[model samples]
Target: MRYKNLIFDADHTLINYTADERDALKRIFEEIGLKFSDKMLDRCCYLSEFTWTETGLYDVKNERIQREYHNLYKTHLDLLFTRIFTEFPCSFSPIRAGELLLKYLKDGTNSISHAEETIKKLKTEKGYNIYIATNGLIDIQVGRLKRFAPYLDGLFISEELKEIKPNPLFFKKILERLNCTVKECLMIGDSLLSDIAGADGVGMDSCWFNPKSKENQSGTKPRYEIKDLTDLLQIL
Candidate 1:
């Protein structure tokens, strides 16, 4: 085999998260007596991506830094809801509104096409060690991967490890855990920053799973590119 270990990103890489995210955002806003608009959804997405990007910058090495990380995350969420209500003229309190949206996002996820089957073939038939290297809330990533848990050899989550990808340390830790070298592994994910860049940092081969054929402007390049999940079967 070309690679013995396969690291996959859980969200857009293996799951169709856009529809679920939009519906969840809409439902949360509606339940709070606010009119859900595409603009609101777009704003939510912008805020969330910014918050996550800021949160991922902190690499906690001690208890104090870890506490600061949590504080930073809470502060970001606080500002997110405040901006939401301020910009949209909602009557609801930001705290409660934020909680409702968080609850929905944590509990909902939908798998992408051929994700389960492709994983099964890789793990069962191909005999490759498969793990999910994802950055998200522990409970949320767990909720999404629970059904695939038995098939997966391991999961490296940002919330639990206090580490996010695009950082070489995240990939280093995963490589250590898997007892594999960078040459022996391949990263498959949608994000250039978190997946491809991080893998590049650690000298690991990466495959960009661009299902939408999105243009790559991030400058970080992948060793391979595939539009469909099942395209992995042929590559391996």
Candidate 2:
């Protein structure tokens, strides 16, 4: 095999999180009196992850410095809230919804999902030493990593490292920890900008999981590509 070490993204790639996120956000809206409907909330939830890395719509804030993804995410959330406020037929409080949304995102643990049995296969069948490199929080990532994807060797989360993805330093940090050169590693993720671009920047190979046939517009290129998690077995 050309690739030996494998680095995976946490959400969407290894975990089925979009649906849980939407349901949590919807619950928050209803709790706060904002009235998150089944259809509208679902649309926003689906759109957020679908367009996540490519669409530039995410509010991923960091204590160090804000990133474009974070800015766009906030903008998208604001727009969603604005629409809910003005367009919704029911009366509600946006503040409460926002509170619920934050709490839900932080408190919900099982919200982290696995990509079917792919995680198990990667550990047992493939015998690939796997690790997660993501912009997720440390506590949440560690907790979820332990529960859903116990096969992982380690987790590199931005909140703990004080850095986010697509930055060469983030990848470099993992390389140092693993004592592996860039050539020995492969990054598998759903985002071109964060995961793929970051890995490529370090001269490391990457596999982009294009679930939505988004290659036409992503503009960023990866070392390899796959459409589904099951397809990953064929690549490795």
Candidate 3:
């Protein structure tokens, strides 16, 4: 095998985050006594993505800028309800709504297709050290990834590291903690901006998990690309 360590992104790579988000959103609406509809969910998703993009969450070019934007975005949780419930005539405060959303999101445990089986095979048969490197909230991610605990060697979360992906420091910290060289590891993820670019920035090999065959408009490229988790067996 060319790589000894396999670093995976949580959302979309190994977990069905979209499904989790949709389910959590519906539950939150119900808890808050608000009617939920698919259109409302779509609007919320759109606004959330737009907000993250506009806040430089995906495009920060340097560690300094990344850190600054990350800190500023923390308050986004408090304002999320304001952005999504503008026309809903809700009485719940943004802070309360944010709390409810996080509560439900933390309970979500949806996994991607073949995620556990592939991870198990890689760990047991291939003898690779598997770890999850995610930029998601620590509490939510921890709860969501409970099913993969037996297979994972460790988890590197941005909240705990005080750094986000695309920043060299984030990947460097993981390498330092793992006591491994960059060349010995392979980063596998769905995001071109975060996972691929971050690994590339740190001189590490990367495999883009593009299940949807999304167009790659970003300049940062991965060393390999796969459309499925099982494909990792052949590449590794």
Candidate 4:
């Protein structure tokens, strides 16, 4: 095998984050005394993605402009509530709403197809060092990975590490921590922009798990592309 250390992405790579997040959003809205609808969910997702993208575009590493994630998360919740109130008939107390939503999100769980089997096969048969490299809230990603942590050698979350993906520093930090070279590690994930691009930036090989068959608009190419997690067996 060319790769010894396989750095797998958590969400959408080994776990179905979309399913968990949607379910959590619905449950959170209901618990907050608001009606949940697919449209509302879509809006919430859009706003959240937009906010994160815009924030990411800035030089977040700069000390003068660097902001705490808690503050950003609070702003996200506030924006979500304001949008919900404006477009839909909803009422809720703002007190502790962010924390309540975070609880629901953190507790939600969903595993991707063949995730456990693939990990076991790679570790046992291929003698590969499997580690999770994910970008998201520490508590939420950690909660989601609890069941799979026993199968992994290590787990790295962006919030705890303070280094978001698509940035070369994130990959560099992971390599430094593992004491591995870029040529020896493989990045497997679903996102073209973050997973593929980040790995490419650091001269590491990447495999894009396109379960949905989404077009690669970002022009970032992965060394391997597989439609299913099980397909990884053939590659490895």
* Top model number, lDDT: 3
Better of 1 and 2 by TM-score: 1
Candidate 1 Cα deviation (angstroms), residue 5: 1.3
Candidate 3 residue lDDT tens string, 1-236: 89989999999999987788788888888887899788988988777677666666666565555667546455565656787778677888877887777778788878888899999999999999999999867877898889999999999998899888878999999999999899999999999988998899999999999999999998987999999999998888
lDDT of 2 at 93: 54
Per-model TM against the reference: 0.81, 0.75, 0.92, 0.84
Q: What's the candidate order when arranged by decreasing TM-score?
A: 3, 4, 1, 2
lDDT of 2 by residue, 1-236 (tens): 66667888887776666655766776765565664557877666655555454444342323233354444544555555545566555455554454455556554444222364776787788887888898865655665556555677888887667567877888898999899899889999988877887788889999998878884465667878888777878878
Model 1 agreement with the true structure over 25-134: per-residue lDDT tens digits: 78877787778778779888787677656664334334454445545655666677787788788878777766666567666656888899999998999899889998
Clashing residue pairs found in predicted model 4: none
lDDT by residue for model 4 over 1-236, one digit each (tens)? 89989989987788876677677778877776777678878887776667555544333444432335435655666666566566766666443555666777777678898999899889988899999998777887788888777678999888777777777888999999999899999999988877898899999999999988988887788999999988989989
Each prediction's total of clashing residue pairs, residues at least 3 apart in sequence or on different chains, is: 1, 4, 0, 0
Candidate 2 is scored at a TM of 0.75
Estimate every model's Cα lDDT from 0 to 1. Answer: 0.79, 0.69, 0.86, 0.79
lDDT of 2 at 230: 78
Evaluation by lDDT, superior candidate among 1 and 3: 3
